[model samples]
Target: MSNNVPTGAEFKEQLRAGAPKMGLFLNSHSPTVAEQLAHSGYDWLLVDTQHGPMDHEKLSNMLCAIASGGAKSMVRVAGYHDRGGIQQALDLGADGVLVPYINTAEEARQAVSCTRYPTAGTRSVYFPQRSMNKAGLLGYAGNANKNVIVALQVETAACIENMAEIAAVPGVDMLFLGQNDLCMSMGLYEKYEFPHMYTSPELQAATETLISEARKNNVILGLFLFGTTRVAEFLAKGFSFISVGNDLHHVLTQSAAYVQDLEKIAATEGKLWTRRPTALF
Candidate 1:
């Protein structure tokens, strides 16, 4: 048994206490953006490492930035990577992890395995990861199981096909949808905001099925949204864990708005502020 200071992870406790939480994605290379979002009172932050340019080195600094903001951190890791990445993410003091491209229950099991110590999973035992406070390991192993949130993605036809079993995985805490990816897989890529998406009887049935399966198995249903546009719709559909917009998206959105506002002001004052992008939005 090791005696040292323990890491305090707050997200899992909020989850267990039946609180619904919201957060934003952090993909900017700038650590200050992460710190700013953290201080914005977001319940959590996802350091996106899957499809974005943010790497481990940058993520490390972002995690440190997040610490000061007092928000929990999660890493959305690429599915192609394996245990090594998962271990590294945990060691970096992330409160949890969300793995992408989970297409089966076995895949869900694999994701959960990497989050725990031996007997519970195959994650290598090492007390020296940054998760420990200055004091040391301090019962990290003993508390990890309860503190970490192991969430798996269910965003493909096959995953939805096996949603029931995946939801039943013993240690799985949440199932999130890669909404954009899932839409693409169904050949409905940009139709998410259109009426056809819901009018299609087949798609509607599948969504209802997924929600039923998650609730039946006692797992939280999560959705990563592109913006606040559909947050209300998703919540009405029963999403307990919600997130909207990445750092980059937020910047692009606000910057475009600022330019538009400036242009309008120039028009009112009879000066030309004509630098609007053709595709701003």
Candidate 2:
């Protein structure tokens, strides 16, 4: 580990201390891109496996690449109940795991349990794992519980209703708000359109509920912003852990800008061409 890179425990401490830690989502599955983004001054990088294509081998390699750039690595495992996925990410040297769709305290407990070993929780130990290799057998076993972060996604109406209990879960370090899913759950997505859905009165109330409960429980609050546009706004609202955007989004947006610029230049030169529709994937 690089001296500049904070350990998982340190990263958690930073968040708890109210530092605005910014990060980007790695959906590209390419370690090269992951490493580049890690070096781009973000405090951390999340390897998104829930919607991104990444197998165990690819995940491990991406984690290694992110580490090489001296930034903390977090893996968003495929599901909240995926004990194996959680363990695999931690064992492969990821600083933390983001478990999605945790709707209740019991589910939150289960997610935390998967991150711990033995008496603390139910995580199975493997001596030859990357975690053990990095920290040594005894060192890894002794500190894994404290060093690993357990972040749960709060994206459903049920989770909002049970926010108090979910935030009070012993080992739950952070509650990450998945805005798109939350909007869908609140029926704002179907009722309204694109940006308007995000600003609905119902969604705003739910967000306030989340903030209040998180502050009341002394847990860190995280959010996934669509882009860098609303970063300052969310940070002002006490969201410290924020992912500005993802790799693919940046690629598409930048590529579209370049193409548009070329079209403008061609038009000035008396050249005309049909424009294809842009896909925002």
Quick one: best TM-score, which candidate? 2
Please give the range of 10 consecutive residues that has the lowest summed lDDT in model 2. 272-281
RMSD in angstroms, all models?
3.7, 1.6
Model 1 steric clash pairs? 4-138
For model 1, state the Cα shift of residue 213 in Å. 1.2
True lDDT of residue 202, candidate 1: 54
As for model 1, its CA RMSD to the true structure in angstroms is 3.7
lDDT (tens digit, per residue) of candidate 1 on 114-138: 9978789877877677887633675
Candidate 1: lDDT of 175?
84
Q: Candidate 2: lDDT of 68?
A: 85
For residues 52-161, write the lDDT of model 2, one tens digit per residue: 99999999999999988888889999777898899889989998999998899999999999998889899998888887886698998899898998899989999999
TM-score per model over all chains: 0.89, 0.95
